[model samples]
Target: MLQVNNIEVIYMNIIQVLRGVSLEVGDGKIIALLGANGAGKTTTLKAISGLLKTEEGEVTDGSIVFDGKRIDRYGPVEIAATGITQVMEGRRVLGHLSVEENLMVFAHNRKDRKEVKGDIEKVFEYFPKIKTLRRQTSGYLSGGEQQMMVIGRGLMARPKLMLLDEPSLGLAPLLVQEIYEIIRRINAEQKMAILLVEQNARAALGIADYGYVMENGRVVLSGAADMLKGNEDVQEFYMGLSVAGSKKSYREFKHYRRKKKWVT
Candidate 1:
């Protein structure tokens, strides 16, 4: 249960990133926020996570409520303590820390030490590579492994709602699929609600129960993921083309190249 009221996030008074943004996440459903770069996806996540001090960005307009509690006013640590965790973009792992140590850092703050240890084992079970590299420094992990470690560390918190930002970014297609599959498993098996923010609209929509399309700052479309997936406008604009069985096609290839230009 997460509700983002008509919230506006402003930066430096000159820049406004999220404009009257509103959405909901029901129990066990994966809700996706799809948009291009600078579309306020990350800003929305930051606002929800309390990382963007509300007084600074100032949800000057609306409120965000989670698990029946008004959370828009709380700070990042407070939000995390309330069972909302964010695995931020770019896999922000502590490079100097060992894999196990990184997990232990989060676990130390949790309520149940025995359960935390059990969850650590469960995370390792989910990503065996992390277990194998327990003694290795995080800097040595591959991109996909780093992503797994970040997700695992978030799991250590036993969050009721997880805000995942671009879990598929920088990974190969196969790894992207692996990551999404794990997200699906977490929702299906663990019954965790998720607010997934991804530029990879196709993959995101494919797995999400519901989807929201955002542009510039506002939500342009919101509906069932299946409907958005079939909508021609979504395909031409946000999703581009289907990359089902084959490699990114000629048109898709060109679209990817053009997108990379802007992203870089």
Candidate 2:
């Protein structure tokens, strides 16, 4: 399990980006962090995974705890080795490397060659298509394939928790559904925990056990996924759906949410 407690983040030690943002992911559960652009969803992930310093961003307040220990000061490599891996927003594969080679890079530090091979086979089990492209250049794979490959690479780490940012970003709807299915399977079968940050609210909430909605760098609303889904404000703002399938005027929707009454 992971806990982020009242954490504030700042960039260049000047501009504050996350204002007391907090959330949690329990063992074998999926938690969705949903918001529009500039809402600090990614900032929260960077804070947890210790990637903040790379961009001159730092956690200025509170703490991030993994399992039971504080992990706020650790570097990304140390964080990854602690059974947490981040699949960033962009699919960043080594373009020149073959798919298998790209995956091997994550497992390269381990001395157990047979275990590494079995892990690769396990990835293949979840992603049969990746097997065919094992020797092919990663740069040449389709966007959906590249996305699968990135998640497959994360699996090579055998993480207890996976920080997933925008996993369904540019893929087709069918592919998005397919990927979510596999994600659910991994959480169930592998006992993996996922902290999913996404702008694709519906898809994320569909699979998440709990959901948090952020606005202007703070958590405004959070609850059980089903409760958040049924919330009128969440329905109008994040979901783009309304009661009885009737559409509300843009002005009316804004007025309802901007009051912030629902959040209180």
Candidate 3:
């Protein structure tokens, strides 16, 4: 469980990136944060994961409460040790390390050596392709494969909450579908709580239990994923479509609004 209160983050020279953004993720539920670029989606994730440096971009207000503990002031390593791990936007993997070695790197902080091996096996079981490429260098893997490896490494951290930022970005449609399927499986079967930041609204909402729409660093809407899926504003602004079965097409609607000066 996690609660991000009305937290604010100001970058260098007081550039306010997160404007009192707030949201919640229930235990084992997938909560998707949908927004365009620069809506502070990634900033929210970094703040929660303790990757935001205090001296540069401070948490000017509010709190980040995770599993009954305040973690706003904690560092990234401390956050991981507290059962929170992040799979960032780029899916950063250790380029020189082998697949198994990358998984092993995360286990240094883990106390259970026997369980570590079993846990690595569990990752391999979830990502069977990783097993086949166990000895291969991560730098040589394809983008989708590298994403899987990053996610596998996160799993090795034994996270209570996984913050996945744009997991489907830059991947092919088929690979996106496959990765999403794995994400769904993790949330449903493994009961892993996920905070998903994605521009792929259709797919993210398709798999999410609940959704939040952020605009200009503030949450504009929040509801059950299905409900938000059918919302008119969500469809028009975010999904780039008019209301379902409307006589006026999206282009026609936009033209009319523009003519009337209803849209700038």
Candidate 4:
């Protein structure tokens, strides 16, 4: 379980990125955060995973609590040790290392060598394709394969909560479907809670139990995934499907007031 409560982040201690952003991820449940590029989705993830500090950003106000422990002040390594790991926007992997080596790199905090080896097998079980390419250089893998490797690498951390950022970016439709199904499976099998940051509204909402929409560093909407999917604002802006069958530009959307309100 994780809670991000009214947290604010400042980059370089000047540009404030998040303003009172709050959300929750319950045990083994998937929660989606959907918005356009500058809505602070990735920053929210970085804040929770303690990656923001790497960019000279810090949670300046409010709290990030994971299983009752305040983790806003912790570093990335400390956060990961607490069973929270993030797979960033890009499918970032060690380009020079073999797939096996890339996966092994994450097990640094893990104490048992034998258990780490067993965990690698578990990752292989989730991604059979990666098992075959274990020795192959990770950079040579295709986009879909690299995405799989990234997710597989996250699993190697044995995380209790997984922060997934734009998992379907640049992948084909079929591959997106496959990866989403795997994500659902991983949730069911590992009982790992997921906080998904995505622009793919249809795909993310399809699998998420709950959802939030952000704009300008704040949460603009929150609801059950089905409720969000059926919402006019979400349909028009995020899903690109409007009941009126017309998309509104950002300018038009700003002037157009929401008929359905959210919890502020």
Work out the TM-score per prediction: 0.90, 0.93, 0.92, 0.92
Q: Tell me the whole-model lDDT of each prediction, alpha carbons only.
A: 0.86, 0.89, 0.87, 0.92
Give candidates' CA RMSD values in order: 4.5, 2.5, 3.0, 3.5
Which sequence of candidate numbers ranks them by lDDT, best first? 4, 2, 3, 1
Among all windows of 10 consecutive residues in model 3, the one with the lowest summed lDDT is 255-264
User: Candidate 2: lDDT over CA atoms?
Assistant: 0.89
Distance from true location, Cα of 250 in model 3, Å? 7.4
Residue pairs with colliding backbones in model 1 are: none
Q: Which 10 successive residues of model 1 have the least lDDT summed?
A: 255-264
The digit string of per-residue lDDT tens for model 1 on 87-156 reads 9999999999999888888776777887877888999988887788988999999999999999989888
Q: For candidate 3, what is the lDDT?
A: 0.87
lDDT of 4: 0.92
What is the alpha-carbon RMSD of candidate 2 to the true structure?
2.5
TM-score between candidate 3 and the true structure: 0.92
Q: Tens digits of per-residue lDDT for model 2 on 1-264?
A: 799999999999899999898888999999999988999999999889888888999999999999998999988878878888889998988999999998999896677888999999999899997899999999999999999999999888888999999999899999999999999998899999999998888899999999999998999999999998888778877777765446656665454434445443
TM-score, prediction 4: 0.92
Q: What's the best-to-worst order under TM-score?
A: 2, 4, 3, 1
Off by over 4 Å in 3: 245-264
Instruction: Estimate, for each residue in 103-171, the C-alpha lDDT of model 3 and write its tens digit.
Output: 999888988999999999998888887799999999999999999988889888888899999999899
As a whole number from 0 to 100, the lDDT of residue 241 in candidate 2 is 72
Per residue, candidate 4 scores C-alpha lDDT tens digits across 10-98 of 99989999999999999999999999999999999999999998999989999999999999999998999999999998999899999
